[model samples]
Target chain A: MVETKVSKSQTKSTSQLEKPPSLMRGLMLSKITSWVLFILLSVLAVVQLLPLVWLFFFSLKNNQEVFNLSPLAFPTEPKWENYVTVWTQGNINTYFFNSVWITAASVLLTVFVASFVTFAITRMKWKWNKLVLGLFMVAMMIPIHSTLIPLFSFYTTIGIMNHPLALIITYSAFNLPITIMILLGFYYTLPREVEEAAIMDGCSVHRLFFTIILPMTKPVLATTAIINMIYNWNEYVFVNTFISSDRFKTLTVGIQNFIGQYSTDWGAIGATLMISIIPILLAFFVLSNRIVEGITSGSVKG
Target chain B: MLYDFKKKGEHEMDKVMSDKKVILLYVLPALILIMTIVYVPIILTGYYGLLKWDGIGEKTFIGLDNYSKLLTDSMFWKSTYHSFLLAAFSVISLGAYLLVSVILSGKIKGSNLFRKIYLVPMLLSSVAIAQLWMKVYHPTNGVMNRFLLSIGVENPPLWLADTSIVLYAIFLPIIWQYAGFYILIYYAALKNIPESLVEAARIDGASPWQIAYKIKVPLIAGVIKVTIVLAVVGSLKYFDLIYIMTDGGPNGASEVMASYMYKQAFRMNDFGYGSAVGFFLLLIALTVTWLIRKLTATKEEVQY
Candidate 1:
């Protein structure tokens, strides 16, 4: 309540200053220019949204209707069956499951590993902590594309080719640096007194981490988990290169196969795209605030 | 009492030391994981670039032959040039869009709604966006041509089908998808600008365009630098969108280094050549990022 009153007062004081007539007119002209700018931005925003909107309209049309009719026109008959057809024939149910399992496992592993590492580095006085942090920063600079072939070769040599766990491991490795960086930032913000008190109460390091630190860091963990889950679920190149078998394919790769070189079934493609994005959308909706905070904080920092 | 105190003090110190060790143990697992997956693979890529091995065959020493070939390879040079063009287009367009959006965000009604809508494309997978654009750029019945025809512009050029326009055509979807991200960056930066500055400028008879250019742009210059660096790196390493949309098609007009490398390694089974391409890409990205940093290095620390 006090904070609200302070903010309200600040806002009031900030808006009270007046200007001369000429200055007011300049401000008015600025307002007019701003409105013009707003309209132009709105138009551009609509153009940006056009593709997704087009996807929805095309999804409702059958192949014959899609090819023959106007691309932007609403379907004469909304073929809702296309959704079912794509779901069934595209093996999206299995792909969805694969995506879920891979994403969930990868997120869980990455967050767990990253948090543990962050907990250790920030809490423990290790001599090589700076070195370890530097190593992770270097890891971020190495583009994943450069390493794909070598990783595939190594995975094939190990005979874990087409294994879901292999993909999970790869995702976890790539995701670790970002997760660690985010969790480290969160951990830094945490007070040391609680952990110190826990230590005095004869709490084991493991118990302390599980009971106190983990619970306190839930928001950051959730953000990291969701971000990792989104990336893993939507990732195409690695999954496509690593997982060859239809059984092991994630939704992104599975959906890609729907679009052959010869022809693309628009309805099926749209449905598959929708199905593939549902998990990410669901996760985003649930954790939108945390995700937004995490991205802005994480990406903006050096 | 003295014996008890001594024992307790030893126990506390031991606990401190043990806790430190435990922290190391916690960090060790992740450090090892990253090293094996990231660092080792990079070193191996460099090593493999020095060898002449089909991915399936026995490795043979090739020294710097692959790297030398990359220097002279027309296709490699073409793709590099194309990547630079794509990066330049993405940077300029994205920067412009971001600046416009940031200015609009100030004192605009429903700006929050606009921001949310603007960011939707960023949320969609690149492959999906690429596929959607491929449909939009279709030759006979594509939306682009249809719109052009409706506007009475007959004989609209084929987008992806035409060799000349294919690279730019592929770039359109990428720019559309990524512009929102930079806009958000600029928006966040713009929001950090003190309202008093704008108000003061207004009271001094400054127009909005002048305020935006002379005030907001200068303030958010740091973000612009970062955006340019990210754009350069991202475009240089771009693959999925192009691969999905055109597969660097219409006589390889849309090929970038990463896609070209993928074709070389996977399609042609020329692992050495692919590695060279990858190395060149890495070299260029790092050099450009460094150059931008050096150029944009500022004395004032603008807190945002």
Candidate 2:
């Protein structure tokens, strides 16, 4: 293919330009040079993690100690009760539960719907397939702010304003393009032979997709699922603008108001933030590779 | 006869797979929903900018009035400048990310762990990141000042409260949150360069710096361009953290386009004006994305 040949020729220059290195290579290869670069990288890594560490320390400290002690020091006695109090007394419990269900519903809808479209475009035959896919892809470029006002008025007019359905629907709709993009690459990689054999065995189109093709795409599905879950869980602007009441707010919006109420209580604020981020942190611990892959594939091609 | 019969059965299977009804069923759900929820609203936002009505009241047509007002609005222009400034800062910072990523991709140990740690700030909600960073910037009992004090600095200027320095202070966490993402992207790209090519470069008289600058960076120019588009347009839509952290505070010093639009709509109750701001943001985002892609685009693909 021209594509393969083009890339080979691009690398050919670097491959063919070889000659024996000169004596100056000895000084250039000195150990100190690489070590200095390594140390710089290590500093960046530490800087990235320091704020969370500082947050944890402050989370355990009450006002007396937070005011008196060093910002980085561990508290003499950890007050894990800050977590318990924020969970029980404040509206955090409601927000936490709301986030769980909304995130679940939205993730499921997004992945399934994205899977459906990806399946159709890559496998099933259609005339306007590329055009439709283009529509979804271009939708990614349209900023959400552009859509917020009309969506707000539309939801209000339709009488679904302030409802969880509003949040779930918007999440599902907005996330569709990126989800489809991630899945599209995987779907293209899938062999058509499996679906062909199933169709030869008299399997219906729906069954062919749901049973034969979908199972083969599990790894990619997981990637898209995790991506969707993170976005849905951390979403802010939609919930803030659309939802007005306290009972229905997600953690992002909820925490903003919760912190506003508990403004002076640094321990509780820190504890609340820690609780909100733990799931994502745990998820990263498990699936960092997939997240890296999904983000790269989704962005690089765009 | 047997061969003909088998071929006929294959044709039947192809017919079922390409069934029009099933294709519609599969794609239409997503297509219809996006049309109503995403595309329709985008069109409406442009239209909404033309009206002189409150969000709840009857609409009155005012052709180009809000936009004309926007053309001369100093506050709006100021916010737009702040947004562009943030975008410029983010794009310039990518060089540091690229440097770190290049170093990491040179067969380093524990690079995976390093990338994950860098991404931790990115995973948290903006509100949570904002709240944690608010503490980090706290004047009296915060970690930043504590460090400044320990280092023997005479005066630790207030971070979030100082108008001139507030925007830069917020940009730190933006760097923290996105540094991992860009690094991960760049690292992956660098790793994609073939080992044989690098070996060939090494055999020649080129040093590591030459190989990195002359060879590696050129190969990943496409990815670099994509990140530029992302950071610039993304900065235009900057809201959550700024809204949660300073709320465009210290006398609107940190106001970006999205946060300004939010304030006009939600705080000032000027729905028409806010729509104009939001529409302008969308236009700005699209234009910048297009312009970056155009400027960075190559006629012949930079293969590999």
Candidate 3:
């Protein structure tokens, strides 16, 4: 019986394969095989998204609903107020603003500094160019954990341990390697004739970099900026260590403490977590192509 | 037009491009920042390991004592063992990621959308991922236990609290968080393979599996080696999720090297010992990275 059933399906598939050669090529696999592959891919996608889906549902649910209902069940009435409560009750507002400004400041600082350095290395003829480029490249491999203890002491001695500047400067310094790596390729491929002409026409190096070269590199700048923004925004260790005051804490660490206060309040905890992730999600939706491009360009060539 | 003065202009261009002051002006700020922030502190970490000072106290140099203690400390060794375990798991999982990328890079429908969906987890903060997974493993009320109960099982293992299974429990989220990243990298590399090569193999009657195994994989061997280094080094330095999720807790069951170093310095105030662990971590990361590159060195890199 099993052999007959298999033979029947085989005959059906053979009939299906009688289509045109172009269609067969487009199919890439037999109909049965392609369906199986597609289904497997879909299953993987669902598994990847299930946790976030569950989180969104639980955020709308009260403890009673969460503890009683099936784990996958949807909330009958979405509790939008859970968001309002978490926003008003905790220091989440302060954390949100801190994340926004610190991420912005760090991204700006990193892009400008990286742009200047990349310009010098790629465009300027200088001794020690390869050594300097290698320095930045090697910095990417040094584990941040190794630098923590001494950095903690350095900030203490400099009296910036608790200051937001500590977080900003550290974010920019560590991020410089990847940002410059991304910019280096773009800078190298850029047409030097425009800048060469500008210089020959007595344009100062500063003017050439700012007005002509900088404007031309805007697309890559955006890529580096978004990449840096994501890293700075999601950063936890620096904020957790450097900034101890409540007012200065970013969302990453602030939400950790905030959730502790409401250990049993599933709705509130879920809402807080959602709020922390929403900005990144929004950025992803709008600029996903750029994010994908930046990540690939940053790592692939290495 | 500029070719008229190309000869004399070459000298002028050389002078402008190589100006000492301009180069210094452009490079100094970032150069100093990296030197002070990254380079100096790593050196200081090695130096601090030689002292026996609390963070706030005067230093008394006790050369090699902390390093010697690191050699004998069972807890330090345990954490180091756990870090190596995580690295092994990360390297092993790269195979699964590569397989998925091979399929996704094929002429599958909606591959772009599928790639983005997989990447959602990678974009979220580690704290959020940690916090969310905490709920998923909440023992009594989490999705895991709930599903287990519904299937007529009377008891489900305490995912994060049980020491034996806690490391594996933590590994699940790490896999979840990084799956899309590795998949994306491999997919990009696979996509970069010249289509003509795959077409030529097909014309010779090679199966898809045979094509992937023989032609595609060999061509992207350089990328695979780089990823191996990334996964190993990244796993060695893994901290944030484990720190936030477990805090190396429940009798230090899930302690890894980075978290252990953090606890020693920050929580326990043993700055000197923490610096030792931190320096050892740096050494291990650098040595393993170099070792992997040397081991995986091909006589001649495969080029198309």
Best by lDDT: 3
iRMS per model, in Å, is 3.0, 2.1, 1.9
- Give the per-residue lDDT digits (tens) of candidate 1, residues A1-302: 67656654654466554322233445467558767888888898888888777888888887888878888889988988888987887777788899889889998999999998888777767678788887886676666768877887899899988889789989999999878877878898898767666766677888888898999998888888877877787788888878888898888888888666225677877777777766656766666666666665555554
RMSD of each: 5.0, 5.8, 4.1
Worst 10 residues of 1 chain A by lDDT: A17-26
Off by over 4 Å in 2: A1-29, B1-10
Per-residue lDDT of candidate 1, residues B1-304 (tens digit): 9999657755664577356568767987798889878888777877888989899889999899998888899988898899999888987896587666666557777776676667677777776777778788877667888889889998998898888889888888888887767777678777878988878887787756687888888887877787787788888888888888878887888888889989999889998778777767777777887898899899887763
lDDT tens digits, residues A1-302, model 2?
67656655554554343322323344345446667777777888889989999899888889998999888889999999999999998889999999999999999998998899899999977799999999998888888888888988999999989999999999999999999999988889887677777887788988888888889999999999999999999999999989999889999999889899999998999889888998898898899888888887888776
The C-alpha stretches of model 1 lying farther than 4 A from their native spots are A1-24, A261-264, B1-20, B196-207
Ranking by DockQ: 3, 2, 1
Give TM-scores of chain A for all candidates. 0.89, 0.90, 0.90
| Order of models, best lDDT first | 3, 2, 1
On residues B1-304, what C-alpha lDDT tens digit does candidate 2 reach at each position? 9999778777877798688999999998899889999999888888889998689998889999999999999999999999999999999999989988888887566787887777778888888889898998889888899889889987898999999999999998998899988998898888889988888788776778898999999999988988888888888888888988899988999998989998998888788888999899989988998898888878987864
Estimate candidate 3's alpha-carbon lDDT, on a 0 to 1 scale.
0.91
DockQ of each: 0.44, 0.53, 0.60
> What clash pairs does model 3 have?
none
TM-scores for all candidates?
0.91, 0.94, 0.95
